[model samples]
Target: MNLPNILTLSRIVAIPVIIFLFLTGNPVAQWFAFALYVIAAITDFFDGALARRMNAVSPLGRMLDPIADKLLVGALLIAFAFAGSFTTGLTWAAIAIMMREIAVSGLREHLGSEGVTVHVTAIAKYKTMTQLIALGAMLVVPLVPGLELAAHGLVWLAAVLTVYTGVEYFMKAWPHLSGAKV
Candidate 1:
């Protein structure tokens, strides 16, 4: 119920609007969607900082934050794929990033049952940054020439980092994943 949590919930609430804008098929809508996405991504950073500064962290916020992130990123990637924005290697790269997210989330949930928490790493944070930048570029690609290529490159980079971080998390959690109980 604090500001940070409010911001996090706002990100979740904005998802439907973002989706609507993306589906509108207008250049203006695409710009609006890109702005919304950038705002959401900024909140992802500020919310955590506010939570830490205000000491208002809650289990619900902890749970909701990552889910919101995943939902936003996944929805954008799927939307782009459906819209044919990913005509080249970007589609597979997006798929790879999405798969890593799913795998890591599942692994984290399983590990949580064993009282083991898998903290987000610096590399994971970097991957998220690249993904957001890539997604933002893709959203606005139509408005700018040659930006789509940059977006694709960013996505590919993010995909590689996503896979690397996914492997890192899995390896770190392997012992707990081996039928260990809390």
Candidate 2:
């Protein structure tokens, strides 16, 4: 495997390590979890860049990259909710984020099958950035004052962006869906 693929796979591998650390119930272990999450998130950025720069992009990397991201984000969100750390708003935010993820993934798959491609937009990148920061903040709750509230606010913001992006995608695919030229 290329370095980019290795990095992508590393992000997936980091998920279990993060969960184990979070389950340790040690405050220090939570910090370790945060560190691993940061590393994995960083890999998400570097992997794509490396793939492009090295001309090592592959179908497997394309498939694994997004899967790794969704798994990491979903695992952390569900873990937070299961740990009873989420406020009601945060819970709703998490639900919306997860729901949007499922919806967008399906839409993208259908569009891809139709040979309709939608490029990732700035808003989409922002959504991911906000999510990573917000989740990391939530992970270090005691360390960050009022982080639960802050993280929930961020999650809500991300959810809005996520929904908007999904809608944009659907709008882009609408022509093809309607049997019109894309």
> Top model by lDDT, which number?
1
The candidate 2 region of ten consecutive residues with least summed lDDT is 142-151
Worst 10 residues of 1 by lDDT: 173-182
User: What's the C-alpha lDDT at position 8 in model 1?
Assistant: 95
Residues 1-182 of candidate 2: C-alpha lDDT, one tens digit per residue: 99999999999999989988986779898889989989999999999999999999999999898889889989999998888878787788888889888888898788788776767788888888888888887788855676767767777787788778778777877887788754
Q: For candidate 2, what is the lDDT?
A: 0.85
User: Which pairs of residues have clashing backbones in candidate 1?
Assistant: none
- The positional error of residue 26 in candidate 1, measured at the CA in angstroms, is 1.0
Report the alpha-carbon TM-score of model 2 versus the true structure.
Answer: 0.93
lDDT of 1 by residue, 68-113 (tens): 8899899989988888889767888888889999999999898788
Off by over 4 Å in 1: 179-182
Steric overlap count per candidate = 0, 0
